[model samples]
Target: MTLDERAARRRYATVSALFWLPLGLSIAPLVLLLTERGMAMTAVAGFFAAHSLTTAALELPTGGLSDVIGRRNVLAAAGLLNLAALTLLGLGTTPVLLGLGMALMGAARALSSGPAEAWYVDTVHAHAGPDAELRTGLARGATATDAALAVGTLTGGALPWLIGLAPELGARLGEATSGLVLPLSVPLLLGAAVEIAFVSYALSALPEPPRPPTPLRHVLRDVPATVAGGLRLGGRDALVRRVLVSAGAAGSALATAELLTPGRAADLTGAPESGAVLFAALACAGFACAAVGAHLAPLTARRTGGGERAIAASLTTSAAGLLLLGVTTALPGAFALALAAVGYGLVYLGLGATGPNENDLLHRRVSSTGRATALSVQSLALQLTAALTGLIVTVLPPGPLPWSLAGAALLAGALLWARGGSESRPYAIPDATGGPDATAERRPGHGRPLGGRTGARE
Candidate 1:
């Protein structure tokens, strides 16, 4: 059955919430549970590395699978994988089992990266046509996702502490469960249960047009070809490339902040325990600010005249925030601390605003056939850049240098889009009439279009 624009947006928001809440629940407890199970800090880091590598490896392949097979199926598979991963992580004592669980979790993350958003865009286009308003719905979905995350984080952290208050009851429960159920394990186990609901809801709510059946061999062949096409999209489309590079820049900024914030907090508070608490509070605040920014994305676009300009403005704001953080690092006292908090919130807010606008522009350029793959390519760019930036930030001498480096990267990204929204033109794409449609004229010497004659409009 076809869905109207409103119904599509509602379902997208719901799916996004369901998909991310479980992750937020686990974020507070996963590392603690691992260390509690006798793994050292180095081993815990290794497990995290495993997760990252697995996710990076599978991102494009799973994305192409969604493009070829369908969104609903891939999303269901992701939920199922996450369920198993969470279960194993919660109860397993052996390092092998824990590592495998982390790997599976990463695989689930890769599979889930693009299908929900792709489905939302496809459904809206199916009902409302290509030019339908998407930024509002996309903004709503992002807001829901961040809201769920913030709520889940608070609940997750509270559960274990609340359980700790009644030591006898906690001991009794642990004894009854044969050492398998601990207070720290509660969040992961709860997340596993949420996955069941997520899978069921996705199956019932996310209807799609039927895809033609294909042989297994054909499926394998098409996936790689689609991934290659997705990679080539960046080379041919300048705006898409800008989106990708900007994502990397954002990733760099994010990595720098995440890597440095805890130590800085500890320095201010004079204790790691107090710093962890402060960081947790800051995380929740960051998520809340992100939700607010997402809610304002459509209005930002309207005021700025287009998505491209909105992105430029948002990134510039974020760069300014980072620079503020760098400047505050040199100052001392509670006033500097307050300023740093504002800068931190600004970073998340600007990044949140950038997301919906960037994706709106991206969706308008690519067809449904490669939509998920294109998103996967964008995610891969972010992940790879963040990982690299994490290493680079560590090696640099501590203080404002790292923050300055990240700010410069973000500013460069903003500059790429400073050419104004008038230059924001749709490139050539295959139209219903089976010929290239030059929806907008191409500027001179901006580079040639792919698979089209030279001097042709793109």
Candidate 2:
């Protein structure tokens, strides 16, 4: 890789880590705080349910906006809005306030999602290469996000008590705004710093791909047609479609588990009051392990071969973890939770690693305007799946819900990804068979051999 390619990848990775940090940071304490503050648990679930639906509702429009207006602009707006939402969460003690806060957060999330990826891809594409380097940065950044969530959750959970135990570390935090502001304030600060970094990176590192800047008036006229084209093509593009559907199903299951795990653990351990804290810590630990697993993705691929095999293996492991959780009668369920988390993180790596190439393939079938719309359809579908999964969780015994998702992901996901045809590309770090030869060669993922070095060779 050229110096520019390497630098762009690094910049993109940093952006990924920063963007994901807020999601987990907010999630770690959200449930416990909401419930403790007198909101019903079911209502809490409703907040996310609404959140998922609203995000899907907005995904297409925002994605189009990115195409029309430029990703950097949309992303900066997302960051500012995100900070506003987090601040609202800190002050909220009622359902309406909480709901509003969550709604804003959802809006921020929808705005932030695709544009960042698009920006990175466009940047890499402009810099005398293909989409591969961009994808590598994405995966690396995703790993960083996972690690940050792990750190945030662990720290957030323990900080209050630690403050009590050792006053020095948190003395000023307590003095300035008491404990509440400190916990939430930190995430906002990190988010702002990262958001500025993203904007700066966009300005400095990413070269403008030779493509013409889109005109806003023209984009308004064109987006509908572009969206229609993406829908029609995505319907026929079996690989992309399958991946979309699979991600949604897996998302629903993951959502269910995310919603329930802390509650279940809280009940079992008599930590209902502080369950969020413990859950965050444990969840982060599991997520951290998963990030390690993600770092190992290239190595895993070398050993497993390309295609749906490694993904299938991850799903099966998830199923086993789910089953263990369902059947276990005691604290061993903690182990089950860990297993489920491990499975969850790897599944993300397997699937997310595939996302850019899928986009590249879809891009071949459509224009830049159409690319944004196609991405939107995928996002819309995933959100729909998550909302539906809410209904499933409302009924299923919590433990069984995770198992159900695991089984569906393994059995159904495999069938879906494999439905299109045999992969013509080498199932390696950068799967390039689906796009043009030049694009494939420029792809820059580090290999993750099963039980071997990753990026270490670099």
Q: For candidate 1, write residues 87-142 as lDDT tens digits.
A: 99999998999999999999999999999999999998899776566777888889
Cα shift from native, residue 271, model 1 (Å): 0.4
Span of 10 residues, lowest total lDDT, candidate 1 = 449-458
RMSD (Cα, Å) for all candidates, in order, is 5.9, 5.7
TM-score of each: 0.93, 0.77
Clashes of each: 0, 11
* lDDT, each prediction: 0.85, 0.57
Q: How many residue-pair clashes does candidate 1 contain?
A: 0
Model 2 deviation from native, Cα RMSD in Å: 5.7
Candidate 1: deviation at residue 429, Å?
3.5
| Model 2 vs. true fold: TM | 0.77
Counting only residues 3 or more apart in sequence or on different chains, how many pairs clash (N, Cα, C under 3 Å) in candidate 2? 11
